[model samples]
Target chain A: MTLLTIVLLAVITFTTRYLFLHPSLPVKLGPKMVSFLNFSAPAVLTAIWVPIIFVHEGELNVNPLNPFVLSATIAVIISAKTKNIYWTVGVSLAVFVAMKFFL
Target chain B: MLTKKQATIKMIQKGIIDMLPLNLAVIPWGILCGSLAIQRDFTVLEALLMPMIVFAGAAQLVATELIAENAPLLTILFTVFIISSRHFLYGLALRQKLKVLPLKKRVALGFVLTDELFALSTDKKSLKGKLRLTYGVSAGFSFYFSWLFFNIVGIVAGAYLPDLTTLGLDFAIAVTFIALVIPTITSLPVLVAVCVSGVLSVVLKLMGWELDLVIASLVGMYSGYLTLRFTNQNQLNEPEK
Candidate 1:
């Protein structure tokens, strides 16, 4: 069952990716649509990350002591400043680990 | 002093070198995904094969989480499909440059076309024809290799190590998403879209929606689109006034 799911999922993903590769494909996205598509990455990623930080097991946990809030803030600052994924992940992971042990 | 063959090899090497910086970030995420797969009770072979076949970090992680929750197969497939739908935009943007390649090479390139690879290969001046193809191959394969290697290491480490989830390593997934998102919030539309989608996701989840992420993402994209349209209209009206 799992294998089937993976294969089916891969097929769907590959087909979507290959949608515009062929010239004969009739799908043409207008500039407005393209602009809309451009927001998909940020929108989807934010949606995924926000719940992970603010909600734990279906409950809101935005207190000061929530390790994720602090760690995510540090990660965002480092990522925004340095524009480097390595530093963002490293600093965030360290902060998270420290908070887990100490706080 | 380099022959023609050596020059081509040099181009490929440069492609790999260019991708090295991005791999620094990819490695940890790959490892985290691998460990999560083990925790989710995926077999060693299944975990190893996923990166090779799927090659999508965010989608693969989401799949593992869904599988662990015993979500329906259809739901898992749908979620991953939506998560990776952005690749279609990448493919469309690359169509002009890629049209010059033969069908076989185009298919090959399409299979491994990632965000990093697309960004690196899209430059018209630096890469052309055979060089572009070679660059794509080299960049794609190196990423593939390291991604798989780190995943294997993570699986092994997860097996021997205590519960990694307790260590808050799972939060690394969220961190990865943060790293991906923060760099892209440069404009008002994007900012509004992100905030709207994020808030909607939390609200929908609180309301016990089945697919809150997917719905929130679509609404967010639409909201961003509307904002872009409104801003463009305002700019046009200012020119007349």
Candidate 2:
């Protein structure tokens, strides 16, 4: 069953990516649709991250002592300022470890 | 101007070099995904083949998690499809340049069209004709190779290493997403969409919704679309003043 899921996912992913590459299927997405697609990255990524950070064991955990939330907050600030992945990952992991050991 | 052959070679080399930083950044996530696959009880072959076949880091991670939860096959497939829909935009952006290639080459390139490769190859100033094709292929395959290499290492090493889950390394994926999202929150519409989707996802998850991720993503997209439309209308009205 897992194998089948992986294969199906690969097929769908390849198809979506290859859809416009074919000359036979000329797709002309309008400006509105394009703009919507532009937002997909930010929207999807944020949605994915939020649950992981704020939710623990299927419940919301927003306490200040929660290491994940604290590290993520620091990481978000660093990422926004530096726009660099290395610093974001480094600082987040460091903070998470520090909080894990000390707090 | 350089000869065609020289230009093609230079472009390919440039593509490989340009992808280095992102490839480095992807290593930890790839390893994390690999380790998670092992923890999920996936066979060595299954874990190794995933990055090579799926070529999507986040989608693979999500699918692994869903599969481990014993979710139905259809649900897993649908979730991955939704997560990967962003590739459609990448395809759209490269359509004109890629159309000139033969069907076979186009298919091959499409399989490897990742976010980094697309960004590197679609520079309107640097890429043209055969050079564009070569450069994209070079970058795509380089990313593919590095991703597979690190994932394999993780899978193999995961067998010997202590339980990784206790270390909270899984949070790296969330951190990666934060890094990705921070740079993109430039416009009000984008900000609205991100915040709405993010908060809604947590709210729905707390409600015990089975498909909170998918529902949240769709709602977010809709909110962004509406924001864009509203802003455009306002701009048109302001022109009259």
For each candidate in turn, the TM-score is 0.74, 0.76
Model 2 residue B112 CA deviation (Å) reads 2.8
TM-score of model number 2 = 0.76
Which 10 consecutive residues of model 1 chain B have the lowest summed lDDT? B118-127
Residue pairs in collision within model 1: none
Tens digits of per-residue lDDT for model 1, B74-166: 788888887777677667666656655778877777777776665455344533667667877888778778888888888888676555444
Supply the DockQ value of model 2: 0.56
* lDDT measured at residue B17 in model 2 versus the true structure, 0 to 100: 80
State fnat for each of the candidate structures. 0.65, 0.74
Quality class of the docking in candidate 2, CAPRI style: medium
Q: DockQ of each candidate's interface versus the true one?
A: 0.53, 0.56
lDDT of 2 by residue, B128-172 (tens): 667766877888889999989989888988877665544655577
lDDT of 2 at A63: 86
- Candidates in order: C-alpha RMSD to true structure: 4.5, 4.2
